[model samples]
Target: MRFDLFHTRVDAHIRKAQEYLQAANLARIEHQIAADHHLALASMYAQRVTWLEQELSESVSRFSPPFRGVMTVAAEGGKRGAESVVSLQRSAPVSNG
Candidate 1:
């Protein structure tokens, strides 16, 4: 490939990387939201936990093979944080306002 063409391809890859990063951030946000929902549910949190799992699974599914591995790892970490938040919320009842 010509130098310019090669550089263009590289640029495209960079943009894809950025998009992946954005998706990863969004996944993290989704996890946080689910955690909040779970906390709000407290004793009735099983459904919310399932919802969180679905959100994470969907986000994980949306990833392309090239990106899935990294996204999966990052998403796992985010999900853990979310679960922790839910646990804390359950431990102490709090108004959802």
Candidate 2:
């Protein structure tokens, strides 16, 4: 189904976004100013935002049950992982602040 394809794309992008976001956060904490990390983060986010917005634009269409469940789980896991990293980063002290 078309929705399945879109869901799969979204899941793929989400996974990549999660990875890049993690790396960006790590680089930020490590004081790496290579800028590539920031660029990667921005690219990942752009892909994710585009995919999500497209999905939202077709919100009236329903996804298959299994695909819907998978997407939900994937998104939730991504959010939890990102949040954990963010929390850790916040609690970490700045050596040069």
Candidate 3:
């Protein structure tokens, strides 16, 4: 999936979890069953958010070294030029499929 879309999905899950937690807190005084149901939904969303975050972290790590190297090179006044960046990109393994 596209990184932007994946990020958006993660954000949505986080929002859903927060909303559910808020609903549970609000309902706890008057309706125990409703509060329990909301808490369950919140927990499910929280778990989903955790899983998605891990996936994102793994995905970023796959390309992090080359990108980080390029950034460092660039920060040092680009003495190595763009060719080094290209080579770094080419050398990185393509694991995502």
The candidate maximizing TM-score is 1
Q: lDDT by residue for model 3 over 1-97, one digit each (tens)?
A: 5457444577778999999999888777568877888999999999998997677556656775666566556546777865455442366777988
TM-score to native of every candidate shown = 0.36, 0.29, 0.36
Task: Report model 2's TM-score to 2 decimal places.
Answer: 0.29
CA lDDT of every candidate:
0.72, 0.66, 0.72
Error of 2 at 11 (Å): 60
**lDDT (0-100) at residue 76 of candidate 1?**
68
Clashing pairs in 1: none
- lDDT digits (tens) for residues 16-45 of candidate 1: 999999999999999999998878788567
Q: After best superposition, candidate 3 residue 30: deviation in angstroms?
A: 7.8
Tens digits of per-residue lDDT for model 2, 41-64 = 999999999999678546524764
Compare candidates 2 and 3 on lDDT and give the better one. 3
- In candidate 2, what residue range of length 10 has the lowest lDDT sum? 80-89
After superposing candidate 1 on the true structure, give the runs of residues whose Cα lies further than 4 Å from its correct spot. Answer: 1-8, 43-97
Ranking by TM-score: 1, 3, 2
Q: Which predicted model would earn the best lDDT? A: 3
Q: Worst lDDT window (10 residues) for model 3?
A: 81-90
